[model samples]
Target: MNAKTPDTPIVIIGAGPAGMAAALALHTVGHTPILLERYREARPAGNILNLWPPPIKALQEMGVDTDDLGAPCHTTFRGVKGNIRADVQIPDDVVKAYGGGFIGLLRPELYRRMLAAMPEGVLRPDVEVTAIEDLGPTVRVSLRDGSSIDAAAVVGADGIDSMVRRLLWGPSERREHKLHIIGGYTFADVPGVERNEVVLRHDRTVQGTYSSIRDNGRDGIQWWVLEAWNPKAEPPADLKSHALSLARRFPGPLAALVDSTDQKHFQRWPIRDRKPLKRWSKGRITLAGDAAHATSPYAAYGAGMSIGDGYTLAQELTGVDLTDAAAVVAALGRYDDRRIAHTTAQVQQAYVLGKVFHHAPAPLRPVRDFILDKTPMLQKQVGEKSPAEIVAQLDEMGAGLVRA
Candidate 1:
């Protein structure tokens, strides 16, 4: 077997959550990793966000500060009339262990914390990876500036339109969910808003939801409305007005929260993701995060899963000899085996949920709502099963980032 140079670093393309986490975790595992970003600085793509406990634990183990990172929320699915449809029942022990079951925080704050924990000189901004090739013993990453770096392994942590993914597994069409979400956050002390809770409500055709958020020691709330929309159509002229109109459909402080949000804090996103790839690694290169499995936000675990990917990748490569082609391939195969199934399940579930909630037939709307309201189907699927799956990762993570 060809041997790689020990001094060659593992190169990660993209400085998003996945790339950054991978670099940190790799460092924890005693590997030098170079994180490259195409942008001038690392930034989050969206504002409103939530994260499950697995990712939280992963972040903390990687040395990112977890003290009051976000508001701890008891999330529940509700009908538009304020009746609880399904309660997310995360175990109390898990909640206590991770600081919260599902955390509510601004995406930028998360970026800030992760970036703060990042080691200096690891992240190279403004250096775009234009091409990647596996050369048996080493992988070569060509930059936009005509320079190239050779590494023992390369991780494609780039976003949905990942160049490494395209190079490794050809191009695949994006799967549009035909839905859009308008969301925003506010620090205003809006009356009638519940604290420390995520109230996700759905009407016949729209989903209006809000959750408590804590940003930098300040208590606040974040809200969003999701509905079917044509991907090609122009966005609403007035985003706040449109969001407020949707908020009005659901009872309680959703509308007021929307009204209280500053125009600068509001944002909109069209939901889309690519189909899950059957394989993510080939030779000395592998994929992570959206590059491996682009998922819709309906899962609310996209970023969480991305962080988990980095942590898991680091674990799989902990003591493996990166120089040995067989060992590197075996390590990557383990990473794929561990990540693909879980992330793919999430991607498919989120896609199906979007279709069911927003794109369902008009005639079947009442039938679906009635089932969700009366039956334990949703509770079984989302409330119990989903939490079980998420919490299981904590155990699977096996103590910490560094293997014993």
Candidate 2:
């Protein structure tokens, strides 16, 4: 096949946050990208979410209006007794620039903002990509409709069961954390709820937490309760009641938040993630978001990291000639080098946290709690290390998507 032209466009599969961000970032960097979503429209898979500073910066750089996007929250890890175990201290300048240490909001609002900023005709819905072939200078993507298109590159932003990832790297087992989370949001006035704060509390076994959220100028709170669950077992028949029961274990307005939540707002997810791959790109094709690194919610940065992936990918691909196989390979290799180590650390950390918090032995429960309460280990790990990483990412992202 002849070398593809620059106008051939980079094809991005999936329309989730990662895919949409990729399309926006790629467009910002002067690349023509086609975003394909199997579904009729781009939709959020869950409701409640939080984003750190790095993603906020990425959104702004991609031309998405970050003003009043979400509730700015000062997050703290606390015990059931309300004693703060660790305070996530993001730099004041970062908090000011990005809105807060962590921005809490409903997932759908993020989708709406990203979708609004998406270039017209960039996203093609109801188009299912069935196969991908890296043909030296270009990639040919076959659709379920028995049609095909050639692209300069293919980015798989598809979710956990990513077909692109499977094609690049062989299938790997989904490592089930054997944990479940029941989450919901409420716009009603809940008494005793803290404003603009993320109160994450843990009791003996269950983790009940709530964060302030703002949706289209309406202020509210989003909460979730996570516990060890049998992966093979059926979900609770009454999710609200079960969440309420767990919420009651924590001292605060968590239960009130749950009670105020409507039935329609409730959501549940069984936590699972694939092992991080050592490499994310091969030839003219690469991976992004959950396709590259499926993460447990314990990281709270899954979506944030996915947004960062698109931002970073665009930066690496800028000024590179896509028609040249060597140039494409080199650019994708740089993407892998920049993303792999950081994502792998986050994935492993989230997995270990699930094991430590919910799956610890009964006899070690008190010991674990005592250590967490008495020592600065959690403080150093989450409060310090996490912020440092976020700052580092922001630095690495530089001034904008396109290099000066």
Candidate 3:
């Protein structure tokens, strides 16, 4: 076998979906990569994540079975506000193009499943990375424990606030948004909301999502509220009150979900984003997933994009002359080139949706709701304006890996 770095393993930063998926893909290509995570272990957090179809094929290639991950189906989206409520039907063609539907699994369970797929001793927890230096032939990664190691290549899958991204592009190069989200899950399910549907509640200034998440043999309600505010503003000391304030605009079920949430389970996340970079690699160090391009949850493709990155990147590197430093750099470059456009579109779509959905003026709300109710445009907006093009990219990635 042709080893890219004969003496050193390719070091993968972060053990999240993207990093672990990268490890899985690299292993498929006969390369062993060590995963470093800042956390001690995968703990349960966040609500259900909709893993769309684009990345499901890549996940299957990496030995992940989407069937057992969660309920793989489309949850009907019911728009609610005041006395007005309407069901938003996604176009059948769009759903069919996406390869059936999505898996609305709990985020932590997905994390655990991906973690368990890795071979033993591949992941190191509680190892915080401090710095990374591109030393031409090898990349040097420094840890918080006053230790460092050299690798033939370094993959930055550390996520949105990626230290690797900061190291590579510096802090000034990154871009973020003002949309702040505070969310939590309740141990009890909300009445009136069906098991296979998600209710979207919105007012003039805020929106919330309510759905059911199954864990530990019982179903619980998982919900989130999005509101735009100053990034520098301090989060409210009374989280419950803050959450209610956002949910006040929403009607019964959403408010009830928030009220049922325990204080311990409440979490606030400042939704941040980064535009696609012209270049995601320099020498042997490069980035994948959120580390390279973090999108708003409006796109709902962040996890899928990151998971697909590992699959596609590994596919591009397979059969290449890894021993040749120049060839390795070129392979990394090709990975970036193939991903930039698609992920950029994802970022842009999410950004625009975030702006329009949460902050649209009162007068424009009618138009927005009318379009969502009467046309298939909303389906395209949530699913990509060019569904065929996105499907083609996903197909190419899957086909390329099969060839690998």
Candidate 4:
């Protein structure tokens, strides 16, 4: 926690939710800020999203409530083998107990909200940042139009392909080479597709889930998918055709969701993740959001993590004078130390969950589910898990992450 100091204009790169959230948090702590975006009119692919519990808590602390944004999220269906008709509601009351409840939103709507909350000059849409130079005490952010400004600190919320991370941390070692993700916002709405349920395909080999957003008359519905694949074989550019191809492989209505798509709507990416860095900052230049930690889309925590980072960074920079060189660098180093472990653990946990869910054969799947289905106590005794109070008992000590 930083003590409140004179306002410093922190430069935030990228206008995605992570960058926007960071900008907002910095503003909350009394800082002048500037946010840059590469696209003048960047619109999300209209992907629907359900905020999980931990992030729900994070957002509540940040001041954007899910209940205020849109509809409540309830689990209509989710499971590896069979569609368990469980009331997996992170129930409104349960969510409220934890300080926040879930709310669904269209990407554009969410984008609009974060932008609207900014204090006028903070967000500069259409301004693309081309280069960033670390000047020890100050970082210079150069935009595409050949303009530059010196700032006390610069944040790279530019995403996994973060230019800042590349310049500073270098490309992290590739954690996995081949991950198949078939995603698209679609128009054809399927019957009984609950607006909140995270629908999982029982054809476990083809792991997929769709969060239901309200149907617009044009694009009736939307959903996305992630599965194991060979990157050298099938990359994401061919996402549409490949998704349609994968659609033909499934037996249930899940395939119908895919059949409704044209190539334009199909989006595919060979999901790649970089191993986490021990340091997320270098002097005055700091990486936040996806720049620091990039997780596969399977977890849907990427945006939320950025929000957390933005808030944490704002908290760290509260008292430092931007003009001071040593303070800026030291603050950044401390920021990295605090965040690297937390974010890396999140990324690694997603990987382990991916392995446990996709690769586990049927027999093991039952035993895995049985333990989970029984009670949280059984789960904790067996492993150090924390999905629910009862679920916390699933995993053993240090089972989720590597902490330095």
* lDDT (10s digit) by residue, model 3, range 243-347: 897787766677788888888778888888777778888889889888888888776678888988999888877876555689889999999888888889888
> What are the lDDT scores of the predictions, listed in order?
0.91, 0.91, 0.73, 0.62
lDDT of 2 by residue, 1-404 (tens): 23456588999999998999999999999899999999999989999999988899999999998899999999888888999899988888888888875889999999999999998999999999988998876899999989887899999999999999999998989989999999999999988999999899988899999989999999999999999999999999999999998888877788988998999999999999999999999989999999988899889999999999999999999988777789889999999999999989999999998998999999999999999999999999988897688678888888888732
TM-score for each candidate, following the candidate numbering:
0.98, 0.98, 0.85, 0.76
lDDT of 1 at 41: 99
Please write out the lDDT profile of model 1 over residues 217-271, one tens digit for every residue. 9999999999999999999999999998899998899999999999999999999
- The 10 consecutive residues of candidate 4 with the worst lDDT sum are 395-404
List where candidate 3 sits over 4 angstroms from the true fold: 1-7, 42-48, 73-100, 144-147, 216-218, 361-379, 383-393, 400-404
Ten-residue segment with the worst summed lDDT in candidate 1? Answer: 1-10
Q: Which stretches of candidate 2 lie over 4 Å from their true place?
A: 1-3
Q: Model 4: runs farther than 4 Å from truth?
A: 1-8, 53-70, 75-94, 97-102, 186-189, 202-204, 214-221, 234-252, 260-265, 356-404
Instruction: Please give the distance, in angstroms, between residue 162's alpha carbon in candidate 3 and its true position after superposition.
Output: 2.5
Stretches of candidate 1 above 4 Å error? 1-5
State the weakest 10-residue window (summed lDDT) of model 3: 81-90
Model 3 residue 156 CA deviation in Å: 1.3
| True-structure lDDT of candidate 3 | 0.73
